[model samples]
Target: MKKNLVRIALGLALVLLTLGHSIRLYQHPLLSHLDAITYDARLRLTQPGGQDSRVVVVDIDEKSLAEVGRWPWSRDKVSRLVRQLTDHYGVQLVGFDVVFAEPDESSGLRVLERMGATSLKGDAAFLASLASLRGSLDYDGQFAATLKGRPVVLGFYMSNGIPQGALPPAVLPAGTFKGRNILFTSWRGYGGNLPAFQAAAPAGGHFNPLVDFDGISRRVPMLVEHGGQYYESLSLAMVRLLLGNVPVRPGYAEGGSGSGYAGLEWLDLPTPRGALRIPVDENVATLVPYRGGQGSFVYLSAADVLQGRVAPASLQGKVVLVGTTAPGLMDLRATPVGEAYPGVEIHANLIAGMLDGSLKHKPPYALGFDVVQVLLVGLLLSLLLPSLSPSRATLLTGAVLAGVVGLNLALWQSGLALPVAGVLLLILALYAMNMSWGYFVESHSKRQLTQLFGQYVPPELVDEMARDPERYSMEGRNAELTVLFSDIRGFTSISEGLDPKDLAHLINEYLGAMTTVIRHHRGTLDKYIGDAIMAFWGAPVADPDHARHALLAALEMQVELRRLDAPFAARGWPALQIGIGINTGLMTVGDMGSPLRQAYTVMGDAVNLGSRLEGLTKQYGVGIIVGEATRAAVRDGVFRELDRVRVKGKDEPVAIYEPLGLAGSVPQAVLDELKLWQQALRCYRAQEWDQAELQLMNLVRLNGDCRLYQLYGERVAHLRQQAPGDGWDGVTTFETK
Candidate 1:
């Protein structure tokens, strides 16, 4: 109970730490990636735009520039363009991509000056001409009247390092645009504020890309830094006009912090369908739907519309964009779609998206999502260590990893923005902590277990046993495992000449080295018989890979013995050569004998077969011989079939395999010789005397004095003399061990 309480306290502490970090670093721009990820999710959740085909663009293309002679065309021409779009094409609203801040330069004012219109009489004539010129310019009052009741959105830019002036009193939103407070800095120039032109359009949006320092356009701010106070961007203002309302009036009558605008929720956009809530970034720039290409999305040329080149049906109700295509103008931006995208087109997509009820929002429930993740991981982690056994705990650990991945997939499918890295890190941290604490509490028993079995098993397996003592016992049991027996050839002679004390010391040294190899391969030492050692798998702890472990142990022991030879030679001792025999079958394996005299061991027919094969290893003249059962159990393919033999006390003919180094690293000659010998064995078993004699002769020449070959040759010679009958089963009875 106390452990559970401690775990809960730790989980709560981690959650609080995460919460504090988020709030403290909320204002930093680096955290914007989270918002970026959120925006991407929004796009996937929302529907595609261009559903109603309400908004359209009257583009200004190269052909139009050719006909009208360069950009910034005379206002008289713009006024006509506006009039045609409204009156002829029946276009409902006209939004200008072009801004007119300065007064009309070509208003013929210079002509009046050149004509010397200084007095009142001349001034009156000049004024009449100016009025006519205004009338001829882009539908000034004529277009304004059309936009009165209908929805219209205009375009403008914010100062990069300065601020745009407040709207004139005549053009301000009635109640919202109060108090005639104006501040001007002459050093910073504000462009695109043509008083007469702006007055004509009902509403406007800012055409700006919130480009980062690295020139990557990621986020857009809803409020722009203008003058001493923040002003809503062009998109926000346009949305307000679409809703038949305006930005909320800030009631800073006392002149403290601006709390009056706190209740402002979302700007509503006006379209042919109806007013729609258009959620936006702090600044009006839309999250670019970058398609990763230069010319990814469809870009229709505006020149086709003016020349009657494009089909009428194409522009009948489709949203068209009117923006500059000139390369030098640099109105292009890097968007999610492409590196060079027209800035004016992004707003068109955004407005269309907003009108179709396709905008996405995360709301404030994202915090709740984080809380859920912490609770899930923490609870699972806290329960795992205290409740599960070691092996079961390991299985649960794997399940936890899989569970995390599954949760992430589910949340993504549901269109939720779940924090990934933070939650996963929390799970990992908690898991490690619990496991460490569990180890700490059981350290004493673990230390004792390690001391007892450290020389008999790998350290990793020792740690596993130490983690959960209840799962394992030294009691005996019958299980299928591979047993290996190795005996040094001619060891009796060497020991016979040595002093007894020196011989005992040397044997201990050799056994110590061999025991290390066995433990490294996860084999439990069974016992020692004079100059021989016995080991078996599936003891104290069961290894599913028992056969593989036995084979590896044999190979490693050979290598270690070779390494020991150099040092032994320096000490005037003969190099050691040993033969190992391995057999796989069911055996009673565990701690046996009386309580006061217990030792880990295995006993069964399989164990006896292993000992008998070790004796036959001298007759085969091989370093290691493995029964067919053992070879089949090995996953590493390290053994090659040698022959079938009937050992003493065993009636069944057993296939034997020679442990030939590693599978891939064996020498080609060794493999070839083994194949030749295998063919000879097949011939001998088939009673094909001539073929068997020829193959056995080749084998004897390549590696002479093998007891099986000598024995076979003597039998074949006798068979040639006696002419044995077909009743012979090709069985060679062995009187061995």
Candidate 2:
């Protein structure tokens, strides 16, 4: 419970930290940039693909520039283009995406006037010609005359530099938005059309777009404030003119004004068709609804229009925007759809979207929406992930991530723009934190288990014990186990022949080989005493077949010792042999020793008997010997009973046997020899000296180097000579260990 509380606390802290960024209490540049990236991707995916036919771009393209001259062309030519569009092609409305900030002086009327004033002062014929040509030479007046009583919405630009030219009447007059805390984009000055042009045109709107920090033109301010008056954008003004010049009113959310935040969310323009509600963001801006890439609107060259090359039916009733697409004009903008997008189409897209009511919005309330979304997702995952298992946690994280993304996409389809980066980042961070913490805890436990039992057992057993660490400990406990004791024969004599260094090397090599055999059979090594090794099974990690395993280990130890013969001889050392004794009984096993030094070992009568049996192997001329308990436990092992003996420390006789592989493994000759040997032992114990002598001689003749047979033969001869009474049982007693 305490651990769970700790994990939950960590998760909640992460939630709060992420929430700080979501609510704008603090800024994380990476998260903000990621959010913008996601917004762009969604925009690209959901764009309306087909062209918007109501708007057409009258492009002053390379062909127009080639036919006509450079920019700042005579206003009479611009007037002719406008007249051709309105009078010849029957275009409904014309909005210029170009400004007439400076008067056109290419007509050479100033030079003509100078000559009339100075050089041709007294010439009557020249004066009469100039008077007749003054009306035609006034190009600005001619352009203004073309705009009079027409639905022409001239474009202008707003800036922070010195104001130039004349601005049209403000859409919302000064003091109209007093006490309203709306953050409309503001500018100090502007470069508008000339006074005569501004007065002649019905309306004009600023053609400035809102460029984001990444330098992409994604939005346009619907209403910009300059000197305490708000003016409409080119797209908004054109939209209003298309709808019979309707008046725009501010649309605010409920209680927005009362809460000191009169956030302008929509621009409400009432028209004959219906009330046109164009949604805006916190900055009173609308996200540009890009229809597609370039060519979303039809383009007609101005030169073509002037030369009557374009068909009138194509431009009839189409709202036309006069703009330049020529590269030298420098009117290209970086937009979400294309890197080199024409600046004029941005207004066309906005106009089309406002008319169709298809604009996606990110209102001021979206901040609250993002905060709620992040809080719900962050806290839910943080608290729930800690208690789940690793697989379950991973599954839950995936489901939540999918759900968050699906919900975000759904909201996007519903025309609401909410950010997803923060919530996604939070989910990933919390999952990594929880998963890493869990791994560290489990690894720490495994390390502790390894440190406790590393030296006693093989690595495989240690891993198994680590799985359930609470079940095993170093405290002493009694268990039915099998213990083994192995010692090198003639170790003292062998050591005397070699120097200390060689002796150490030989002992290490012999001990390593024997220890490998012991561990291979899953025996836990207790300790090494000089040239002897002690090991046990069925403690710390239990094995039900402990006796069988120990017997197999002893048999393999002899085989391993024999393999070292060649190597020992190559080193100019004597050949080595070992005697192993194994026994099974109840014994105390665990860490037991003094404070200065402690060891994991076994101690009991059964353990001592195992040591004593290893000492008796040389007397019996066998490589291995096992007590009766161990022999009985291994049901499939083949054994030859050596004797019934009472060792030095015990009064009761115990049967001892030498293991000879498994049941089907013993040779037929060895089985025959064992049968005859049993008969010889029976006769010798019953005092039939002659029969025992005959059988023993046969056993000797079969194998002359048989130690047990020879020992029994000498005993039988001694009994025959002494002639003891028939009160004897077959048993041998030893007075020394």
Candidate 3:
């Protein structure tokens, strides 16, 4: 039993380990891409807006870059472009998707240094003019004052591992801050921040868009951590600035309402927009829904802004995003909607999503859904496979998979992020377990049963049985078999002084001897009711000689008990006395009870009579008692007359007998005693008590150890003193229960 437990534990452990590994494989990046595809398809089906004016991209093409010179055109040119859009075109909010960190090198600062301090007023004035021109090098002082307080947005970045450089002087307050509120998300590599541009812009946000491994931009970070402080993103900063606010004033905040996304309170901003409502995951990954390709929305070249090629009305009342979209500039990214996507377009989509209140959300119940799915799928497979045929089961499995996919799609369309890979993997595991169990565990169990029980049972019966089965379920129609009940006499007093462990050991040894005799005669061990054994001969499998088998088993058990007593004597334990009754009749025998649980048993009147007979054995002072039917069924003449006593709980008179020995094995002395007892029983039945007493006295003299002779001696003595009644049936009535 312990070995079986160890094997089961090892199997379960291996199964769990394999399941964990399979889940990890399913969560790999390739599967994530499949999940993304599924998400997109569902969104297309559900979201109200089509991939059109809802989202747009601006491109800084090769033509614009070629026409203007390599990247970073003069600040004067940038200033001119800003003027054309705001002054002439009237763009509502112009946000810069670019950064300028260093002072423009070609602004004449070197020339000013070359001029001596002793120079005349004209020379000094000339130096001042050059300095002014140099100040305009970043075109900062020029555009800075022009764009200041105007709805202009500037971009910044956050870093963790290493700073991309420092924040523009206009934003950083100096030193660092810590804890959850201090934000500047980590980043690596080197870059510069445009100090003047940051100073001029009314609001600025970080343009550090996070991309998942699948190259899809799905989420936006609201804040980032840098050094020991937190900083807002370009998109977020720009939105706050447009609202006439700065970094949010931190306080004790909570996540969003009920949806599992947390909430943050900013003293300046009114509330979180839909896009900002969701918190970034540990890796800063967010979901991005791409509208289409490069020219999907609107693209205005920098040169067009400067050359006045774009209509003033076009920028009027519009949110203008100033960023590079030039493919050669490497600002293009890969997204769901396009192979080559502008990085700046990701932010544009986020801003649009927030304004429209259409951002997707991962519902709070997603994790619950995963857990339930795993359990349900596992249990279903566990039960279903055991009862289904292979072909139909395969179809059922396919249907289940399709159903799971459909459900995942539905959840995604509802703007809930459901984990597809994990669920699919669990289902797959269930399928594998279902398939493997039949071929491996169940098959092996059957083989082991055949190997173990085949030699003991008939070949035909063996063929009909289940392998390693817990119960017998045979095709033979259910029928009641005679039940024989037996127990040791005076067991309570014998065990009173023994220690519990010793008592248990002694009882087991005594019961083991009797039980083996029953099994050897093809009896089904019904149950051990206390020290008594309730056994039946015909059950589960049929026995034609059921009554004969019971009688023979009872006789053999008495003989085995004598032999078993030897070891008990050595241990100072008392010898065991057993009473066995045998009878036969019709009764139902099969797996009877609930479908989930059942037991093989026999129940009927004949069975009850057999138990009553066993109880009567002590009253008659005999080791074995058999009902009239049992005596008639057995062809052997081993049974000798015992009594015609009415067993308790029964009104019917049963002729009980004690089996002495086989006719061939009967000794002359035993035969003489049996004859004498037979004569005494006849005398008692005839009411000839004086003659019965003479016969009992002679039998006791032959075998003083014989319990039956002593019992008859007492009966004759009692009957001799009683008056003869006309209605006397000569049946011995047991006065003790």
Q: Give the best candidate by TM-score.
A: 2
Q: Residues 1-737, candidate 3: write the lDDT tens digits.
A: 34334334433443454344334534455446665676666654554443444322334567678998787766667777777777787776677777766555455555455553435335867767766666545355776677676777667655444445346433333242322333234554325455556666666667777676776665666655544345566665655655555345432235322323333322124555412343234333345545545554577777777787877555666677777777677777766666677778777776665555455655435555765675566556545654567677678788888998888776665656676665565556556655665445556656755664443444444545663365554323546466788987887887797888889998888777777788778777777887888878765556788888887788899889889776788887777888877777776665456779655566777787778778887876788888777777777757787777765666766677887766788888778777777898888888888888888888878878877778777767776787568788777665444
At residue 376, give the lDDT of candidate 2. 91
Pick the lDDT winner: 2
* C-alpha RMSD of each candidate structure in angstroms: 22.5, 30.2, 34.1
TM-score of 1: 0.43
Better of 1 and 2 by lDDT: 2
Q: Among all windows of ten consecutive residues in candidate 2, which has the lowest summed lDDT?
A: 254-263
The candidate, 1 or 3, that scores higher on TM-score is: 3
lDDT of 2 by residue, 1-737 (tens): 46688778888898898889988899888787788788889999989788888999999999999899888788999999999999999999999999998887788888999999998989999999999999999999999999999889999999999999989889999987678788889999899999999999999999999998778998999999999999999999999888888998887777233545567788889976678999999888999999999889999998999999998888999999999889899999989899899999999999889988999989787888889988898888878898899999999999999999999999999999888988888899999998888545577768888888989899899989988888888999999999999898998999999999999999999999989988899999999999999999998898999999999889888888889998899898889878889999999998999999998889999998999899889888889999999999999998988888899899888999999898898899998998998888778778889999999999999999978888888888898888777666667889998
Model 3 lDDT, residue 718, Cα: 78
Candidate 3 TM-score over all chains jointly: 0.49
**Model 1 per-residue lDDT tens digits across residues 293-380:** 3332344455555545655565554444467756655677765444676666655555555554554333234556766766666566
Ranking by lDDT: 2, 3, 1
